[model samples]
Target: MDYSGSFAQEWQNEEKEDNNQKGRNRMIHFRMKNNIGSVTVADRILEMAALALAVFLVVLAVALYHYLPERIPVHFNSVGEADGWGGKGMIFMLSALGVVAMAICSAAAYNYKMVNLPFSLNPACLSQQVTIIGRMMRVLSVLCGLLFIALMLMTTVPQWGMQSVFFSFFLIVMTSMTVVLIVYTVWIYKKGRQYR
Candidate 1:
């Protein structure tokens, strides 16, 4: 009967449906964006905590290096004069290197948080890549601390020298881990370029 009016009514109905679909899409997009923002903030906090731990380890290393010798009396004349210097120096070197590696890792972590925190929350962000790197640094730090304790023990327990072979093996492992961490850091930086 009234074909023209009927066609106009049909067009209006289609337009309304399209508008509703667009509105739904916008809401979903906004929600996803908000969630990404939250993830990024959480990642930043984790990175900051890691950074603080790194700083503490560095300070501890320094204090141990300086204070240990003076605080403890060298009763070497009684026990064949324990050579604590070698162990202390080795530990000091390890601690210094650990500080450098941790600093690099912290900078990389901060860059990652700053660059990707606002846009998307990628699973790669929480991947073992960063965790492994951190663990590598931690292993090295622990080794240094252990060496410090060994140095103290050497003063009282001369027989601890029997375990030098084990410590040497761990030193090798530490070196290998350090190499892996350096390589991993480079790879992460390269991969993260796309995210940024």
Candidate 2:
């Protein structure tokens, strides 16, 4: 039973089959890796943008509060004729609260991004910490975004006579960005499952 020729040929065939399989596996893995990387990068960028918007809102609120009395229309009603501070003050407080909530949501998002970065850079090291933080941020962002929307609605709808244009523009930007952030958060969650 001198089976050298047949054995060699069989071995060669097996080797070729393995090589092809390995190539295909490598391609699939490479694509998955690229998707994970892209999703992680997108999440980070979204988190940063959220943070920046939060800060901008807070500052804008403060500035508007300081300048509203001297710069806005004060003759809307006779009740507000003597001093418009009450109406301006109410708007300022609600806007400030909304900004604060947005800031908190942004901070949570930043933490989520930070916790997940290691997993993105090296999926082998994903742990419970990242998963928990990511979930927490997703929940917090939704809640905060909702609260901000409510605050805007309560404060803007009634004051349409005074702040219609400004509130409308701000609401549009805030709502659009909030929706985008929610989508990004969901994407990150799905990608995180892949790592797990």
Candidate 3:
């Protein structure tokens, strides 16, 4: 058994493995490029707005933390009464939740092709679907951030017209999210059918 033959065979195998890895990297890059390229101006605006709202929530929580009471309302009953109390630190958690929502939406937008759909779609329709879904994710993120911020405000200053303010914001955000989800899902689903 010549050692040279075995060594050459091992080198060829290593080369093949490297080539396979490069191919995988290229595929990943292509997917990312396609997703990023498909993002429309409206999507970018929504994403930026979502990020800004999330950051604003964190800042608001920080600014009010010291002034807030040691124990604050952290939960409310269906009747709009505060039913659960927690330390002021819970306010920060609420803001952090907004940030988490923003991050999740960002991920979803970046991997729109991986989003689960109720119906099958042709490959050619993926780019358009990506744009639609990305916009929806960004819009949802913004709405979530607003809702969290409104909740934070309600907890921190229940007396300063916050209750009504928060309730209004809550209704708006919920309605907006519902509409966005329904419209985008139906739109994408219908467009996907045309492609098929």
Candidate 4:
């Protein structure tokens, strides 16, 4: 006689789980919808640029094959001196690794919108943050690719001294990445405040 009451209670429980006070259902739907939908033009362009940078590294590595000596410097010292050497073939591996890194970053950028962010906000703000993250990932990927390419060339060419090269490269790349992180932090702070 009370089976109907039990069924209604079960349904209500399920609804409550799906729809919390914060509109969990809406938040989830927004996340899923905007994940692929909110990709900005700049994000797409940067991702493509990352792919191109990888390809360029590969092509450049191949071209350098003829110029690189049988043994090339593989590692450098803090003072910009070569402390390690390897076969010329290893040059390709450097660029190949860079390409792989770039690919991973590009994938991350493409899927950044799907990542679980800590802050809960309106769909528009969420989309904006996602796009920013995607663009940043793409930019960082390109920077990584460029760094590898530069390293490869520096190691292969005899005229360019390794002195201070890595120091400069790391300083520049680290600075750029730090700036991105700072910007993202500020963005999250401001957007989070709006929701609070």
Model number with the top lDDT: 3
lDDT of 4 by residue, 1-196 (tens): 7799999999999988766855976888776775743666776777777888888998999999888888888887765567899999998899889888887777777676433456554655656666666766778788887778768776765655553665577567757777876776567557656754
Estimate every model's Cα lDDT from 0 to 1. 0.49, 0.52, 0.80, 0.74
**Best candidate, TM-score:** 3
Give lDDT: candidate 4, residue 182. Answer: 71
Task: Please give the TM-score that candidate 4 achieves against the real structure.
Answer: 0.70
Cand. 4 Cα-lDDT: 0.74
Query: What are the per-residue Cα lDDT tens digits for candidate 2 across 1-196?
Result: 8899999999999999999999999998876543322225545655555565556555655665654444333223423222232455565566567666665655654444443432253355333334444444644554454445444343433435644554455456556656765665565556567665
lDDT value, residue 129 of candidate 1: 37
RMSD of 3: 6.5
Evaluated against the true structure, the overall lDDT of model 3 is 0.80
For candidate 3, list the clashing residue pairs, or say none.
none
Candidate 2 lDDT for residue 92: 56
- Which consecutive 10 residues in model 3 have the weakest lDDT in total? 31-40
Question: Would you list the rank order by lDDT, best first?
Answer: 3, 4, 2, 1
Q: List candidate 1 segments past 4 Å from native.
A: 1-41, 66-87, 110-196
User: Which ranges in model 2 have alpha carbons more than 4 Å from their true place?
Assistant: 1-59, 66-86, 113-164, 193-196
Residues 1-196, candidate 1: write the lDDT tens digits. 8799999999999999999999999998775443322224545555555556556656666665654443332323323453333444444555555556555644444233433322233344544334433443444344444434443343323343444454455456557656755665565555555454
TM-score of each: 0.31, 0.37, 0.78, 0.70
lDDT of 3 by residue, 4-118 (tens): 9999999999999999999999999887566543767887888888888977998899999988888999987765568899999999899888789778877887777656768
